[model samples]
Target: MNDSFTLGFGGGGFEAALRNWEPIISQTISFVPTLEGGLKGGMNQREIDRGVDGFKQLIESYFSNVALSENRFTRAVRFK
Candidate 1:
């Protein structure tokens, strides 16, 4: 849950895109630990990082449509 969220634009302007997705990024981060099975599950930082990376890829690559939607914003926010 200590990871940072960063949306990078290759060349075009994407500030709005970044802003639009902030909530999704925050929510994702908040729920990660709970979804990881908690302390008893013996999850380590590396595993958490991997999970974060996977989530990031999932959001950036496939969830663009959901990310763009106004209704499902909270679930999309990842944390930092």
Candidate 2:
């Protein structure tokens, strides 16, 4: 359980998003590992980085909506 949590944290920018979230920012990114993390039964750093790139596309594509994602495994917040 602890390992899963740690990997999730390592996989995504869960902490960074929180910092980005503020009244002024009105934006945040969320990335956490959960059941999906168990999809492959586990994940590695390289795979995680690759996954993050996918999310970055969302931020690049959608500017105003922010990087808010419906994904359970990950979410992203964008800031200027």
Candidate 3:
């Protein structure tokens, strides 16, 4: 019974890790464009708008991922 519980918990944790990686992966992918936008000048309206959109998206995506990852990791650690 104890072994079964341990295995179940471990499996769940592993599954969660796999599930959680996607947003992080996505944000990582999104990072390059965001950084590029930051590094370059945005003197024009369109360029400035692009930079703002990029920043907003990055922050939204990243913070959401952060919240989810933190919750999951915390729960996992607490479970253990």
Candidate 4:
């Protein structure tokens, strides 16, 4: 039986988010190695870094889209 949790976050504010989620993050890191398959099941540092990078990219894109929309909205309001 495997009993462990994984923690991760996305977006441009990872540092800030980590500060708020330190406890949960610590728990997950501590638990991961104790899983049934251990690091061999892809729970190693490389995999975790890859996942975090992917999530960061996704979040950056999302924020970029939001910024574009906000800019357009502001432009429209000024022209109106």
Residue range 1-80, candidate 2, lDDT tens digits: 22433332323465654454442234324433322333353676666666666655544555435333433323333221
Root-mean-square deviation of candidate 1: 8.3
Report residue 80 deviation for candidate 3 (angstroms): 37
Clashing pairs in 2: 28-77, 29-76, 29-77, 30-75
Residues 1-80 of candidate 3: C-alpha lDDT, one tens digit per residue = 22544432224567676675555566566565654554456466666667778867776776576745666534443332
Candidate 3's C-alpha runs over 4 A off are 1-42, 68-80
Pitting candidate 1 against candidate 4, the one with the higher TM-score is: 4
Better of 2 and 3 by TM-score: 3
Kindly list the per-residue Cα lDDT of model 1 for residues 1-80, writing each as its tens digit. 34444533333246655765666667565545533522344777776667667666765654465545555444334342
Question: Model 3, residue 48: what's the lDDT?
Answer: 62
Q: Against the true structure, what is each candidate's TM-score?
A: 0.32, 0.30, 0.35, 0.34
Clash count per candidate? 13, 4, 0, 0
lDDT of 4 by residue, 1-78 (tens): 122334333433656555545543453454334333333556787666666666556545644765345443233222
